[model samples]
Target chain A: MSQPVRASLWAGLYCPGLPLSAVWDHQPGIGPVAVHSHQRGQARIFQAGRIAAQHGVRAGMGLSQALALLPQLQSRPRNPAMEQRALEQIALAAYGHSHQVVLAPPDTVLLEIAGSQRLRGGLQPLLDQLVKTLRQQGFRVRCGTAVVPAAARLLARVGQHADSPERLQHTLDALPIDALGLAPGKQQAIIGCGLRRLGELVRMGAPERARRFGSALNAELDQLYGRQPTPLAGWQPPERYRQRLELPVPSERSEALLFAGNRALDHLGGWLEVRDRALTALHVTLEREDAGNPIALGLSLARPGFDRARLLEMLALKLDRIRLPAPVAALVLKAETTLEHRPPQADLWDGRNHGDAWPALLDRLRARLGEEALSGIAPQADHRPEHAWRWVPPGTTRVCTETRPRPTWLLPEPRPCQRADFRLEDGPERIEAGWWDGQDCRRDYWIARDGRNRRVWIFHEHEPRSGWFLHGLFC
Target chain B: MPEAQPLQHLLDQRSDLWRGRRRPQARCTGSGRAELDAWLPDGGWPCGRLVEILPACLGSGELDLLMPLLAEQTRQGQPVMLIAPPLVPCPQRLHRAGIALDRLVVVRAPDQALWAAEQSLKSGVCGSVLVWHPRGRVDARSIRRLQLAARESDAPAFVCYRRHQQPPPSLSALRLGLEPGPQLTLLRGDGPTRALHLGRANVIELAVRRRQSASAP
Candidate 1:
C-alpha cells in the first residue's frame, strides 16, 4: 500500500526596519529617523523610516547626503545588539504560534505552521493573528507563506505570498536576478549573460547552470525550489526574563516608574505565555540617578501563574509604599523561577467560587506586609500544650491526631497568675512530655474561669519550676 | 401636583420606609445554634455583611460563638482567615471543633490588620474573615470601608474590638456585646437591644469526656 505525504507550510516574518524601529518605536512622532552604520569609517544609512524614505532617503546613502536632503532628519548609530534582541523577542512571539520556529537573523523568523494550522482554524487566520501580535509589539512586520523555508523568507523580504509549490514557482520566476541576493559582481555577471529575469536562468538545464554560474548558485536554487532540504537551527527561548528599560527623563514620581515597570511586565507576561510557564518570584531593581545601591523589590506569589493584572497591581502597591531615595533612571525586571502552567479546571455549574483568586489575594497581602505575616496552623503530636502546634504555609493541611481538651488561643509564653484570680471548673489533664528535646515539662493543666467569666487554660508546674501560669484561653 | 410627583418618586425609591408590609428576606447562613438563629432577624448570621462583636474581655467565649460557623465553612472546603488574633489559635482545638486545619489562614498583621481584613473580605475567596482590633484603634471610616467590602463579597467578616472600648458609629450590619455569662446583647441589628443567652458547649470538655467514655467501654 502507498501512502500520501503531507506538505509542510512555512511562514516567514520579515522586519524590514528593525534597525530603526528597535530604538525609535518607543519615541514616535519625533520626526523622520534613520539608522546608519560605519562601514570602513564612512557612515551609511542601513534603514530609514517611512517618512525618511518618502523624503528621498535610501539605504546605502551617505549620512551627509541624507542630511542635505532633509536637514531635520534624526539619524542614530545602528545598534546591532538592540536589533538582535528585538529579533529574539519577535521569535518569542512567533513561538506562540508554532513550536518549530527558526531564527533567520539580520531579520526574519520562519515558522513551521503545517502541523498547527488546523488547531488554529486555518492558515489565513493564523497568519493574520501572527502579524497582529507583532504589530501590537510595535514592530513593522511583513509575512509570507510558502512550502519552502528559503522561498518563504525571500517572498517575505519582497512582500509577496506563495502558498503552494506552483505559486512559489510563479512568484520566483517573475523576480529580477537581484532578488537572488547575490554579490554585485555575480548579479552583473548573470545580467550580462542575457538573463535579466530569474525565469530565464531557471529554464536552463542544471548542468549548464552549474557550469555557467557555480555550485553555490545551483545549490541555492535547489533549496529555494524544495528539491533539496534546507536545515536551519531552531531558536530556543531563555529560561529567565531580564530586561532593563531606561526612562526618557528621570523622574521622582512613582507613577512614571510604574508605567515603565508595566511595559517590562507585559513582555514578561508574553514570555511566560509562550513558554507555558508561570512565574513564582520576580525581582525588580530601580536604578537611581545618584548611582547609590539600587532599590531592589522582590515579589513572591503564593501560586504560580501568568496573571498580569494581579502582578501589576501588586507592583503598584509596592511602589506606592516605597520612598525613593533618588529619582529612578531605569527599571530592571528579572524573573528566574517558573513552574509548568497547569490551568485550573472550570467548575461545571459556573459557581462564584474565587478558588483561583485566592492565591492572588494572598500575593497582594504579602507584597505589602512582607511574607512572614501570613501562616497556617497545624497540630503537632507533642503532649505539651505549648508544643502541640506549629505554623505552616497557608493552605497546607495535615491530619491532626486526637487529643484532650485544648484552648482556642495559646499564649506564646505562659504568664504568671495568682491562684485566687480564677475559679477552677475542669480537673487537671496531666501532660508530661518533651523530655527528649532538652525542654522538659511536667504540668497539670485545668480549664478555669477568670473573674470576667472568660474560660482560661491554666497550668501548675510540678518539676524544675513551681508556679501557677495562665497558658491559654477558651475563646 | 407637579412638585408632589417628584416627592412621590423619592418616597417610592426608599426601601427602608415602613410600608406596613413584609420586606424581602435577606440571605443568611445558619449560626449552628438553633436558639441564637431563632433570635436573629434573618434566622441566622447575615451573609456578605459585617458583624461586630464587642467582648467584655479577652477570651470571653467570643471566638467560641463563631467556632461553629468557621467549622462549617472549613468543612465545605472554603478558606477562613484570622487576621492578627490576640493570641495564637490552637490548631488542636480547631481540629476537634470539626474545622479543617488546612483551610485556615492565620495572618499576624497587627499594624495592617484592618487593611488585610478589608482585602480578604473584598477578594471573595475567603469563606469568612475575623480581625482583632486594639482598643480605640478602629475609626468610623475604616469600619465603613470594611462594611462596604463585606457587602460586596460573599464572605462574612467579624471585627472583634478589645474589651470595654466605646464602639464607633458605623455601617455594620449587626453588632453584639459578649458578656461573662456567654450572653449576647444585641447592641445593633434589625431589632432593639435584648440579652440573649448563648449556651455554648465547650468542645474541649466534650472531647475529653468522650475519650474517657470510649475508654471505659
Candidate 2:
C-alpha cells in the first residue's frame, strides 16, 4: 500500500464559552461572572470566567452550588443573539486573510489555508497570529491544523495540537472513542469489547466494526483520516454593511468620532469591493449616553462613488456644525444606498474631464453649508418684478421663455418710494393679476434711474391707491 | 536741481531692496472694460487677486459689468460661485446674458457667506467668486486672508459692498468705485491718480458674442 502525501492544509478554530466571553468583554474587570442557562427544569452554569473558575464554579454546576462557592458571583442569562453576532465577526476578521473560510455554528471555524500558507509566511506563524487575534477580540481560541477538516476540528476539540496529516493520526489515536460522536449505547458497546482508544477501534477490522456499530462509525473514521471527503459550506459576506464601533474614549466632540470611524470605513470599503459596488448614500448614527435618541446624519452623493477622502471631508464639514448633546459612546454606520460602478473613461487629448468634479464639490458645499443655503433661481410666470423669479434649490434650472430684460436682485418686500426723487427711464409694462388669490395686483412696472443712476426696478399701483413701490435692482 | 539729484541718489542707493518701481503681481482676468483693462497693470482684470467694487447701490449694474467674464468662464464649463447674493439671481436674464445656469451656484446665509467665499476660493473648484453684500465689517486682515486664499487657486475674486455701507479701507489690489454711467472710477491700482471712464462696449461686445455662440449651440 502506498502512503498518500499530505499537500493541502486546513485550520480549525474552536472557541469555548463564546456567549459568556462576548458579554463579559463589554464590561471587563467588573466582577466574577457566570452565564446561566435553564436545563431540565433547573438553572445551571453554562459557562464560567477565570474568576469564577478559581472559585470552583464550572459548566454544568447547579446555580445554587455556584453561588455557594462565591457569594458575590454575578450571573447573567445566556444571550444566543450576541454569540451568533460574535461568530459572524470572527468570520469577517478571517476574511481579511483568506476567502475560503467556513463557519461551524456554536463555536468552530474551518479555514482552508493551503493557498494562503506561504502568503502568511508559514503554518505555525499564521496559526499563532490567528490565535492571538481571536484572543484579543475576547474569544478563547484553541486551534489545530491537519490535511483533513474533521481531524483538525477533533484535535482542536480534544486540546491536541497537530500540524500535519502524519501527525494527526497519532493525535486522533489517543482521543477516546467518544470523540467519534456516536450514540452512548454504541460507545459503551464498543468499550465492552475492550477497545478504549480510536487506534484500537480502527485496528480491529473495518468490516467487523461496521457490522457491529452500523456503517456510521466506519464512515466517521474514514472522514477523520482524510480517506473520505468532508462537506464544508463556505461563508459569504452579507450584502449590506452595517458595523457599529464603540469608541475607545467617550468624546463630546463629533470630530473625535471620525478617528474611530476610519476602521469601520475600511471594513466597508472591503465589503463594497467584494460586492463590486459603490456607495451612494451613507447614514451614520451617533450614539450618546445621556441623549434619548441617537443623532443620525445622512449623506447622499450626487454620483456613485467610493472615495473615502470625500466621505471624511463631508464628515468634517458636518462635525463642524454639530454640537454634541453628550459624549458619544458608539457609532453605527449603515450603508443606505449603493450602485454598480464602472470606471470612467479618461479624456485623451486635453486630459480634462469637464464638470466631472463640479457635482462632488457642490455636494461637499451642500453638506457643510446645508441644502437651503445653496439655491438656484427659477423664473416664475408672473409680471410683477418681485414675482418674476423665485429661489429654488440648486440644480433646478427651468428657464422662462420671456425675452424682456429682468433685474437680478429682488427685495423680499417692496418698499414705498417717493416717485419725485427718481427719473423713469423705461415706460410702464402693465401687469394686473392675482385677484382670485385675494392679494389683488394692478401695477405698471418701469425701469427707473436713481439719483446715483443705479438701475432700480419699481412699479406704480394703478387701482388700489396710486403709489410707487421699489422692488428690484437690475445689474 | 540739487534736491532732484539727492532724491535720485537715494532711489539708486536702495535699488535692490525697493526695486525703485511698482512690480505688478496682478494677472489679467479681463475686467471686460477696454479703458479699465488698459489702465490696469495687466491688460485686463487681474486673476489670483481680490478686487473690491463699491457699488453706488445694490442695483448699480455691477453684475452686468461681470457678466461677460462669468459667461466666458461658464462657456468653458468652469463654475461661477455667488456667495450670499442679496437676492435670487434672475435665471432668464442670466441665461440671456449667456451664463450657464448649471454652472452657477448662489449661496445664502449672511453669517456664513464670508467663510463660504473663502472656501470656494481656496478649493480651486470655481473659476470666479462673487460675494455680494457680505455682512459685518471686514478689516484689512480678513481681506488679506481672502487675497491669500484666492492666490492659492489663482481664481478671480470680487467682493461687492454698498457705497453707503463701505467697509474699512480694504487691502484689495484693485479697488474701484462704480459710478452713475455703469462706469468704473479706479480708487486703487497702478493707474492715473484721477478717475477713468472705462469703455463698457468692450464687454458688451463680448456678451453679444457669447449670446450668438450660445444660441448657435
Candidate 3:
C-alpha cells in the first residue's frame, strides 16, 4: 500500500458587507444605511445594512426604489477606494497568520496555512483566531478551508468548510453548479443542459465537457480539484502605514480626536507587528471642518518600538498642548519611519532589567517638555570656557582627555561687574583661542569670592574692549 | 507582652514610628567623605530615598558635596541626571572631578522640574538625580510624590532649593542645610541636629595656596 502525501491547505476569509461596513463601522448609532453604486448607468444598491434590508432594501435594487420602499433609509454612494483599502487591511491582518496571503479583491483574502498550521497549533484554531481578529476590527468575516484556493473561496462565499481532501471532494460534489461562479451566459447554458450538481459535472467525460464548454471550465475544475496548480501572486505588506478614520461627528475636543486616532494607531500596530519593525516617527493630520489648513502633529520617539500604549501616550501629550483650530472631520496617521525591532539581550545574572525604562523616560520627557529641554553635555576641546562643551543626545558617552580646574557652572553670557565687587581668590588663568571660528577671545580669568562668600569665575578682557565680567560659578 | 500585641502590630505597620534605640540598616551609597558618612544615619546617603539639600548661597559647595557620589555612579557606567541647574555645568570641571561627562543628562525643565525629577527617579535607570527647584515653590504634595517615586526605584534623588529659602516640613528622607564653609547641618534625619565640616573646602584652599606658592617661586 502507498501512503498519500499531505496536500497544502488554504483558508478563505470572506467579508460579504465590506462596502457598507467599512463606511459605517467608525460612525456609530446611525439610522439604517445602504451603499449604492452605478450599475449599467443606473444607481443600484451594492450592499445594505440589516436595518435597511428589513425595510425591503436589497442588493441590485434601484436606489430610488429602495428610498421609495422606505423613506427613512440612509443611502451612501459605494466607495471602491475605501473598499480596496478595507480589503488590504484585512489582508494585512491575515499576513500575521500565514506568510502566503493572496488577496482577491472586492472582499476575499486567501491564506496558504499548511506551513504555519503546526505553529498555530492546528487549522481550526488558526481559522478561529483569524476570524476573531477580523471581527474585533469591526468586520463581518466567514472562513472556509480547502485543499485549493478557488474551492476555499467558493466554500467561504457559501459559508461552508472542507478541511481534508475527502471532505473537500464531498463538499464540492454536493455544491450546485451555480457555486462554480461562471459567467452569467455560461452558467445559464450549463444549467439548461440539466447539470444540477457539481458531482455530475465532475463525473462527465473530460474531452466531451471541454468540447462542449470550452477549455476554461475544464481548467477551472482541474485547478479546483488540485489536478492543476493555482498560481496566485502573494500579497506583500506595505513598508509604510497610513490610515485615515472618518469621525462620527465633527468635534473640537482633543479627547474625541484621540479616540478616533486610537483606531488608526491599532491598524498601524498590526501592520508593524507583521513586518517585525518599530515605528520611529509618526505624523498625524487633522482634517478640519471649516476648510482651514489641516493641523499636522509629528511625534518622534527616542527609542523605536511598536508599543501602542507609548504611542498613544505621546499622542495624548501632543494633543494636550495644541488647541484645535477647527472641528476635525477625519484623523490620518502616517508612519514616517520604521526600524527593524531588536529586543534587548538580557544579562545572564541580572534578573532585574532597568535599561529598558531609560528610553521610555526620555520619550515621555521630550513629549511633554519639548525636545530642546533635555540634552547630555559633551566636552569639546576648546580653550574658550563657553565653547568647551556642546549639547548631545542623552546617554551618549565620549572620552575627554583635557583635565583642568574649570568652574562647575559656566554662565550663558558673562555679566559685567566692577572689579571691587569680588575678593580675588585665585588669579589669571588666561584662555586665548577661537580665532579660527571668528570668535577670538583674550581674557584673563580669575576665581573670586563675592560678598556672600560664594566662589565665582570672573574675567577681564584685553585692550580695546576691556571690562570685568562674571563668567561662571565654582559650585 | 500578650496584651501589647495589637499595639506592637500597629507600630510595625506604621512607617512613621521612630524607634530611638533600634536603627534599621538601610541600602545606601557612600557619600565618599568619611566625616559625612560617619555623621549620616545610614553610614552613607540612603539609596532609593529623596534627599533635600538647602544651600545657604549659590556656588556654596552644593555641587562639591555631590561630586563624589556623581563620580562613583558615572564610573560604574550609570547615568546621572541634572534637572534644571542654575547655570551651565562646565564639562571640563566635571571631567576633572572624575565625573563622566558623557553619562550626565542635563534637563532644562524649569517649570516642570519636580515632575521630571520624579519621573527620572521612578525610571530606575539613573544612578542618581539632582533637580533644582524654583525658590520657595517646592510644595509638600510634589515632594511626597518625588519621595514615593524615589522609594520605588534604586536611584537616589536630590532636590536643591534656593538659598535663604526656609525649609518647609517635607516627605524627604534626609534634609541637610549647606553653608559656604562646606559645613552640613543635619536638618532632618535619623540622628541629632549636629553640624559637620565636609573637609574638602580646606583641602581646596590649601591646594590653591600651594599652587600660588609654586608659581611664585
For model 2, residues A1-475, the per-residue Cα lDDT tens digits are 8896547777888888687865554345657898899998899999888888998998999999999989988887787776776677677666766768888877878887877777679877887787776665667788777778888777767667666767888888888888866788998999999988999998989889889988988888899988899888999778787877765446876556777566567667757766678788888999997756899887777677677888888887887778888899878899965566855544688565434466677778778888777877667777655666777766666756877767766778888999997899997888888777666789988998777767788989976668999877776
Q: Tell me the tens digit of each residue's lDDT in model 3 across B18-135.
A: 8887765678988866667889888899999999898887777888888878877897888898999988888777877777776788999788898898888887889999999875
> Alpha carbon lDDT of residue A345, candidate 2?
46
Q: For each candidate, what is the lDDT?
A: 0.84, 0.76, 0.83
TM-score of each: 0.82, 0.76, 0.87
For this target, which candidate reaches the highest lDDT against the unseen true structure?
1
Please state the error at residue A120 of candidate 3 in Å.
2.7
Point out the higher-scoring one by lDDT: 2 or 3: 3
What are the per-model DockQ values? 0.69, 0.47, 0.65
Clashing pairs in 2: B29-B45, B30-B45, B31-B45
* lDDT-best of 1 and 2: 1
A80-107 per-residue lDDT for model 3 (tens digits):
8888888988999999989899998878
lDDT of 2 by residue, B1-217 (tens): 8789988777666625555365534457876556666766667777888888887766666787788788878877788988887766777778877777777878887777777888888777688999875566665666777888888776889988865766666567788787756767778876766665543365457767656775995
Which ranking of candidates, highest DockQ first? 1, 3, 2
The runs of at least 3 residues in candidate 3 whose Cα sits more than 4 Å from the true structure, single-residue gaps closed, are: A1-5, A25-33, A39-44, A50-57, A60-76, A164-167, A181-196, A199-222, A244-251, A287-294, A336-340, A344-351, B1-20, B164-167, B190-192, B199-217
- Of the pair 1 and 2, which is ahead by DockQ? 1
lDDT ranking from best candidate downward: 1, 3, 2
